[model samples]
Target: MKKATMTKMHPRCNEHGHTVPIKQPSKASLAQAWADPQGIATAVPDSAMPETINDVPVSAWQGAPTDAAGWEALVAGLSFTEPPVPSAPGKKPAAGVVTIEPDGRVWVVAPTNAFGGYRHTFPKGKLDGLSPRASAIKEAFEESGLQVELTGYLCDSVRSTSVTRYYTARRIGGSPAAMGWESQVVMLVPISELRGITSHPNDAPILKALPAKAIVIYEWGLASGHRVLDTLAGHFTRYGEWPTRIAIPTGMHEGLREEILSPYGWRLLTERLKVVATDAGALCAYGARGQEHSYDTNGPVDLRKRASEWIWNVDLT
Candidate 1:
């Protein structure tokens, strides 16, 4: 089978002032561009692309060898560790891909109306003698009709029949209109709506594994600290986890260290929490209960406004 060609290349300048082809758009830039109607043209599309190149599926027709040694060689440079949650006993190993488009939308597959108890989910299947990376690539094409290149490991989620390792990927070629018989439809969904659309109980861990687009940072106070903590706790209870990203002032870190790190499993929260040093004048003193305060620094102000979702500050005097 003939291999599918990669998407058209665009030129970009590097630090050394040499012009080089930019392989993929950064997630941040994609998110920003998605907001503008003109930016829709910037997104990669499969307009003239073929569903299959020769007899093989376009997604799996990479020019590289499909053997075990070949797959191992391809992933040798990638750095990823096993997830903290171990595979379930007596379950098989599987792999999946979460393909994000250039316009910042995520690809999800509808499994022929709840097939295998899945209404909508990421494309995935058993390893079937292939490496996790290879299996994920093949499964993505068969289930979602998208050729994906794995960028990074997201996490491993233990499901009813398998311990599936999920990876973050970007669409490189192929078209969703060519989805296989297993899938009824393929959809590109916004990140904010992913949690609501892919609402299977087993998918909670996978959803949590996705990186947050923005984090909320606030000053801590004797009275307001507890209120913020209560708000965070409530969010956790409703969402099944704390915000993926959080930041606090350095001075307050010591005072709230145990409360923030102990009960929720330090291993999980440590990576998400950031203790930053703030200038004395950067933050205003707390005002009235349930009141909001704005940041004095332009950086924080810009971050709050630019974030796609979830940004707020609480202050009390």
Candidate 2:
């Protein structure tokens, strides 16, 4: 030690060529460490909760303890309602048209040589490089061989591939016989007969929304009388509207029922509800066929009451 004196190493390199020692990093507080790791939490510590709680003195809760721990415990015990979540992503749009005659007959299409033509549906198609309105117009032409002008947006319904947007339209030209290959037969069906004839349940709402005169024909003797009413009422309430006609017992009134069932009535009643009487003579005389159905009256009174609610709400001007 006397022969050679050693100097302490400096933190920084010296001009004299002495070795420099590496400096160690300072340790941070637990909170600071947590904050540093998480980019969100702040390193700045919050003061501990107040020893005394600033209680809101209401008549019902005035006598509650004001200790901070007790207040925290109370708050912990309280429940909160979660916010509502947004609707799921919407399905792609399928544009289509709903054509209705002045007499409340809706145009529908039957698939040719398919399923024995047992199912009838509205003329609608997927949007293929056309605007919604344009697509609807095109679909009407292609499926029903009819030219139409869109009147208004009717409603939205779900399909196998996407959601369908239906637009109300009036026929301007074209013949149903010339319908495209997609449809075997295209024709006008009465609004009241729609739900029964249409294979797709979704189309019922469109029919219900159409304006039409209702005929309620019933017979006390028929076991299906009440059932028919119940089914019709269910269809009406579900679709937000009522049928064009209903059949009740003949004895409910004295005069000839056929006398009141006029052409204007037939245009309105020309086609009886498929759920009602299936007399071939009556259907043919009215220029239609007997309805094929299986629906029976479940609760005629309750169903009628619900249908009445919708009827009362309708704007019948």
Candidate 3:
């Protein structure tokens, strides 16, 4: 019998800058890793990573740290000027990226010695004459050594010194071993463990904006008038979070629609309803006469067309 040969893997660094062999995780192991509180942590090359790249300080934000007092002082000082000309009144515009892997793990960076009061945080920096999207892409690569493609805008975070725009992204290429000096260590954390790892108040809103295992609710008139509210309330009660997306019928009363969803902070979408309806893993449809059909299949374009009423897509792991 012939034996299968395993491919040799590359060595990466740990938090202490010690070189260690790392192997690619299997699907089963990746799922297990996501559940485990101690997610994957890898360190970048300390000696190789440069302190300054292209005349920009690798440790970037030299203003106050992210503490409450520091943040207040930073904001107050912005109103005053040194050379008789005051700087911009508001926070500096910055951009960052939050990269998530296919297996549902988030990539975070550990700033060197908790610089700018961030021990573990997402990669972000000042715009530096670049657009928000472009700056986010640049910062993600520079801090984590990972090439990422921006998928959607996440949220705008008002930090101690900057108002940073964050974008959701997926990893394309690159390795953590190539991370710049700004990040002492690179970590691949699960969404569940994100809050625990990052304790700064500035990161709370960004974490809240992250997508979760949600049931996208779609309703016309029947479900909207009867079961939609119950379904949304039940989901919120059970999971402590609202559904990802909700689609309403064309003729539903505008005031009623707003009253039902606005209180829960669900943004109603009319123009992009079809686009949201099609991009789901599973869907449940409600007929015009209250007939119902639930589907646990992917790519349900045909089912969507045949259904007379609204459709709900539940993300199946």
* Maximum-TM-score candidate: 1
- Candidate 3 C-alpha lDDT tens digits along 1-317: 99986642224344477653323222112223333334564445432323432222234222323343432342242221112112345778888888866445678888755778887899999877666666777788778877666655567777778888887776666555577656666777767678888889999978876642111211223433343344333333434543444333344334334433221113222321321233343343343344333333211223221121222221111
- lDDT for model 2 comes to 0.46
Question: TM-score ranking from best to worst?
Answer: 1, 3, 2
Collision count for each candidate, in order:
3, 16, 0
TM-score for each of the candidates:
0.49, 0.40, 0.48
Of 1 and 2, which scores higher on TM-score? Answer: 1
Worst 10 residues of 2 by lDDT: 37-46
Model 1 clash pairs? 286-316, 287-316, 287-317
Displacement of the residue 297 alpha carbon in candidate 2, Å: 44
Candidate 2: tens digits of C-alpha lDDT, residues 97-189? 777654445677765434334467777766655556667777776666666666556666764457777777766665554555555555456
Candidate 2 — which residues are off by over 4 angstroms?
1-90, 115-118, 211-317
How would you encode candidate 1's per-residue C-alpha lDDT over 1-317 as one tens digit per residue? 99986643223233365543323322112333334322321112222233332232444333544466755565566554444436588999999988765334577877753677876899998988887887887788777767667766667888878998887776767666556556655666655577878999878877775533111112223433443344444434434444433344555554445433222123223444333334452332222233323233211222221222222221111
Of candidates 3 and 1, the better by lDDT:
1
| Top-down lDDT ranking | 1, 3, 2
lDDT of each: 0.53, 0.46, 0.52
